[model samples]
Target: MSGRFAELHLDQVQRAFGDTVALKGMDLTIKGGEFVALLGPSGCGKSTALNCLAGLLPLTGGRITLDGKRIDDLPPEKRGFGMVFQNYALFPHMSVRRNIGFGLSMRRTGKAELNRRVDEAVRLVQLEEHQHKFPAQLSGGQQQRVAIARAIVLEPPLVLMDEPLSNLDAALRLEMRTEIRRLHQSLGLTTVYVTHDQEEALALADRLVVLRLGEVQQVGSPEEVYAHPVNRYVAGFMGYRNMIPVTVGSQEGEHATVHTEAGVKLVGVKREELGSEAVAAVRPEDFAVVTEIGANTIEAVVEIVEYHGREQAVEARLRDGTQLHVRTNSRLAPGDTITLKVPAERVLVFA
Candidate 1:
């Protein structure tokens, strides 16, 4: 297959509902056979972007191109894009086989071709046992599988999924995530998935597009976005919990000394441009309980200990009232005075 068939491009895409702007000149280019996820909080216009790509919504400004052809003016049905919604939206009266064949039928495909495609899709989802069952008779996860089968039955060039697994329970969600990833790998389809769940995006996306208030915040691979966030918002969103205000005491060599409100001096490499005041971000896992003397060790009183299967999270407070969260395997009793070490490499300095 030609790579152009899977190519999708957006340039300066903008959408407005009357005076309220939903998307503000967004630009993105998704490569063929790549799984790109639009990840952000609610009302971030990720869905709007998807709608525009599917030709379900009109753009207020900018252009959308697919396979080197302008498609912003095309109708949804003419776009040849498969969409799986949060709600399965399956026909209660139609059997799973019939539902999967619905799209092919609409395209006036031959009965043999329709049946062949339906069978293929049903088997792909491993729903052959339920092929004769109606949507009402299937579990939430099964219903979602049918929805996916229906979307892929026609073999559209691009697939757009909007939180397709959100309705499932936790365990089922994980199962479906693995299934979807496997399916994408098998089909090599260019996919644009939208979800507010960070874990889902982190687990499934080859590239993540982070948005906030309809604007693109960052676009990178999951590891890049998680390990090196551009700002405090992105840092906190990626599970960097320990955020403390710090004043740059001095910059020497490759490291800078930051003074916290508790009068504790921390040595960390400055990742962001230095300012008089800044916020230091560090993940809980980056902190360790110090039994030996360390350069960035801080005296803390353990307030609470949370046991999380593999590790323990210690909630502590410094002498000058600075709250600290430390993660360590060493079990520390509550109210015990201990020292925690913040490693310089794991620290993120952001303004």
Candidate 2:
């Protein structure tokens, strides 16, 4: 292997099982030392794409290359990629030290060199005291750390993780996200992570490749994808609420005037040119509970108030029975009538 790291380029990669297509024409490029995530819901083919890249599954069409050299034909064992599985697939009978050194042992490295590499990896993962324990003896988090160590000890140029934190509790998952970020920064490894969890992908990935029904829906940074999605599917998945259908009445530059089927007029911003038929979407926090109604204001009766300590999630319904969720600090009751104003720029119009 060369001393320089390699960028991965997937050119129209496709995977299929007979008539059932799992991945269709996936094209993505990951910069060297960058963290890329294959993000989507279950059955969206994110895992299939990851499997193809890891050489666990062959592509049905197109090519996968690293720094311009073809890699799709290589076997999983020859891919020189470290993998952290969801279950932390460590050998049950092996001690942590042995498990971490297994890859190097397979390559037949000298005893002194193997011990040095494994020791360094163990320290990097902060599992010094648990080095002698077996897989069953360590906490889920620690076992995962060992799995990560095993993957990184070889110091592979690329790292592949398949829903690595799914088995951990919520708190532990958050903790491991931080740990994974730290490792990525320190090691400067090109990483591809597969996850169905939106929060984890947003928190960990430098860039996101959102897939749906065997196709890429969007590819962007977390902020870009969350703030402005290209379509209704992506908007809904990115935490956008108020996905009601509306008819566009007029447009002034990026601003749009539209009305719901109930004749409720709404104003929002459109990133792309929108047709007469479009979807009006706004995030929960984008609305404010006003005391009075005016232009672009929605009158709603509070239905459910959920306390979230720092903020409250208020569910309300309009006169026309359109339900909305708003996050705010306003003290609200189920029977109270409130006015919500959505700023034009904070709203999204997706065609």
Candidate 3:
């Protein structure tokens, strides 16, 4: 699909259902061949925005254009877009070959062209041996592969996926994420993937559009969104573990200096004076267990320990009754005392 990519613009697109507004004045621009992921918790309107983009849900206001032509008015079939749903949506009675060829049949393509495309899609999905098998006969991952093959077989300029891996097992989901990213990179097709799984979105998307309560919270590359979340809500969603409540003492340049509840003074992620009190968002991985305790060091009693393959999760409580989560490689017992070194540069302060 090289040179066939189309720039898509969603300008102030709004969708509402009477009392509940799903997407309110949403605007986004997708560059050609770029992969974008809409990420948020359930009921946050990420799926609603995606359904609107696919023409399954009509926008209550604003417009959608692709390559300078309005497309929100067009029906889904006429829009020439591919959709992959979470349930796979494969026909139980249809064989793998028949399911993948269903779109071409709807268009009444020539028999020769249909067979050629179906064969190519089957091979592309590594389902050559199961081409004659029915959906019931295949595994969940295999069925998902068929669904992906069906969507890409039509060679649409854009692809819309709504949590396509949610139904799979953990291992299968990990496997499919890599395959999907590879497929997207190879095709160079502009893909808009909707997923609530933060890890999945972080792994597969070139850019992320984070949504909350029918509004966009942030839009940027995964690293940008992960490193510099604008608010506490976005920070918590991005896996910030330490939310230290602090009072803003002063502001200068890009950061604001604040006083932590532990009577420690340090620079946090404060962008502006958020009243008198603000919360600092800190990643667990950023906290280091140090041998010496001094200024900016918090002493805590370890409550429990959870081991991850690459790192260890330590739960500790401060003397002032604040719970803290710290990630490190050291092994700690339940009654052990540990000191955490908090770096100001790695902290984000929010109102």
Candidate 4:
């Protein structure tokens, strides 16, 4: 892929509807041919950002650029970008081949060329077996595959998908996620995907931009965002279940002693400058049930134990009344006394 077509730049983009702000000074730069995901909860303006890039929605402020050229004023049709929606907007009456050929037909391509492209698209999505079937004859996953084939058949440089797997069942969603990743790697098309699903973001994105309330929270690779979250919001969003209020008792060397309200002294490393009071977040998997009490150990009463097949999630309340969750293979009954030892390196402190 050419370097020029692989670059995407969003410069302080903002969008508003009357008095309600949907996006606020958002800035991002996506590499050409990279798969990037915009991840956030509902009403967080992720869809608005994708719309702005596609020229389907006009920005209330800021600019959008592709390959260093401003394209915010361009119309959606003229943007030369393919979009796949959650609904798999296929024409019910059209066959798979016809649906994939629709874009080429609209462009007045020769019949021979259209046929070749349509066949190629069908093969690309492995829908050749159902090429003659209409949308009604196909399963949900097959219909979505056809939708994706239609989007890519145009050979657009960029593809935008808005929760394309939302309609599928859990098993099918997992299958489609791998398929999309494979397709991205094979096609080398620059992609911007939007989803509220954290697992989807982690699985599909080369990097992710996490948004909250119309503002950019953090932008990083999955490992970076998950391992070193910037704040409490990002930490909680990344599945850190234990977030307890702590008073910054002392700072020594690289470790900080945080005193929880329940009088438990938890040791953690501070990545940011947190003053006298802060919040400490610990991942469930980071805590281990131990018989001995150590520096970062907390004595708690087991409130509940949930068996999730692969692992057991133990919910316990510390002496300070703070709820802590631990994931272990060792089974524990409810109301059992336990000492949960949190590794200092696994504990994250946020202001």
In terms of lDDT, the best-performing candidate is 2
Over 4 Å off, model 1: 1-6, 252-254
Ordering by lDDT: 2, 4, 3, 1
Model 2 lowest lDDT segment of ten: 1-10
Between candidates 1 and 2, the lDDT winner: 2
Worst lDDT window (10 residues) for model 4?
1-10
The clash count of every prediction, one per candidate, is 0, 0, 2, 2
lDDT of 1 by residue, 123-182 (tens): 899998999999999999999999998887777888899989889999999999999999
lDDT of 3 by residue, 138-176 (tens): 999999999999998998888899999999999999999
Off by over 4 Å in 2: 1-3
Model 2, CA-based lDDT: 0.90
- TM-score leaderboard ranking: 2, 4, 3, 1
RMSD of candidates 1 onward, in order: 2.0, 1.4, 1.7, 1.7
Q: Please provide TM-scores, in order, for all candidate models, with all chains considered together.
A: 0.94, 0.96, 0.96, 0.96
Residue 191: error of model 1 in Å? 0.6
lDDT of 3 at 162: 93
**Candidate-wise lDDT, in order:** 0.87, 0.90, 0.89, 0.89
TM for candidate 3 is 0.96
lDDT score, residue 86, model 3? 87
